[model samples]
Target: MIQAQAIRLFTNRGYDAVTVADVAEAAGVSAMTVYRHFPTKEDLVLIEQPARLIAERVAASSATQPLVLRVGGALVDAARALTGGDGDAPEASERFLLDCLRLMVSTPALRARHLDSQYALQQAIVDALGVDTTDPDAAFRAQAATSACLAVMHTALTRWAQDDGQTKLPALIERALTASFGDVATGQGD
Candidate 1:
């Protein structure tokens, strides 16, 4: 409810124009409730909850599978969980997600906070990949995988947003990852 209201407010009024109080009122709750739900304004926009879901699933994923498979599968799970129940449009949920994503990407104030949100997920990926901190090569591999996976996620999301939420986000994520990393995943790249 807080998230839905906040997105509406942010969409109706620019991110800079909205406030905790504004979202509180829209949600029919007090400022404290809004703050309690989202530690910061950017959290409302970033949908950190969903991101956390992906991180948890990814970090806890079975290591027997390929890294790309695990990351892509985790993303798919998270995206599918967004059921678009906000009563706006069929694309409302994804559109809202895309709006927040765009706002975070373009807004400098929000961008920094977005990075802070991503750090934990990145670290989770690093740990899940079992990168030995003492080994420079292992650390680089982990970093490279994290960077590439993030790129794929971003590309998929951006493309889905551009399409006005017509495509299934998870499918786009898989396609993007496959197109960009299939060779590497299949051990065919030199």
Candidate 2:
């Protein structure tokens, strides 16, 4: 609702160019209402609730999946869920996600949050898989699996953004994860 409007404004107008009032108007709400939902302007873009929910959703069913599948699947599921899923128009949702990502990269505060988001995603993978990071073998495998998944995801994101969404993100993720297993370092390599 309000968040989508804010994302759109921030992406199109620049984060600095958009204010709470502007987002409010765009969302058809009052500034007070916007403030009630998001305490600070940064919160408008930096809130962790959505990410946490995605983590929870991933955690629910991913525990039984194999390491690599779980890590990559959870991230893909989160992105799919957050980007409007099958209900919303696919193209509009893709554009919206692109805007949200652009907003994150375009602003310093949001950029830090973006890094944090990646860390959290990785940690969530480690946790959901119950990878004992203290054990040498477990730690190595966990790190390799998560790194491979994240590398693919990050690559997909970069390409998706660069090509202006000519590429479907899920397709990119699928191709990256399935098509390049040999290319990803497995710690066994060296």
Candidate 3:
């Protein structure tokens, strides 16, 4: 509810104009309550679920599979989960995601924070991939693979937002991944 209020306020009044107190009042809660839930104003906009979900999916993947297949398949799975398995998200969720993306792209502060979020996400991916910290080669491979996958994800998401949510996100993600990594993106390589 607080996030909904924050997004609404940020959308209507602009991120700089909308204070945390304003969001709190709009949400019918105290500033303390809002702060308790979201440590900073950016937290209201930056979602943490996708990173966690992707990491979980990657961790659950079969260890026997090739690294690219395991990482790419996990990314595809996360994309599917985002769309509720129907190639499209529910109307409200879709709108929320689009709005968040729009805000992130347009707002400078949010953009900077997004970079921090991306680094955290990369760390999660590397940890989930179980890269051996002692082996520089394995660590480097995991980092590079996760970076490529994340770049694909960002491209798809930016395209989706650019289209004003007209394109289905999961399809965009899958298409972009496949185009970039070939069969490795889908675990179909022989």
Specify the highest-TM-score model's number.
3
Model 2, CA-based lDDT: 0.72
lDDT score, candidate 1, position 125: 66
lDDT of 2 at 62: 40
Q: lDDT tens digits, residues 18-98, model 1?
A: 999999998899999888878888778876567677777777777776676666667667777673432334666666777
Candidate 2 Cα errors over 4 Å, as ranges:
46-66, 80-89, 133-136, 182-190
Question: Which regions of candidate 1 deviate over 4 angstroms?
Answer: 83-92, 183-190
Quantify all predictions' global Cα lDDT against the true fold. Answer: 0.74, 0.72, 0.86
Off by over 4 Å in 3: 87-90
Q: Write the per-residue lDDT of candidate 3 for residues 108-153, one digit (tens) a residue.
A: 9999999999999989988998878999999998899889888988
TM-score for all predictions? 0.80, 0.75, 0.94
- Poorest lDDT segment (10 consecutive residues) of candidate 2: 181-190
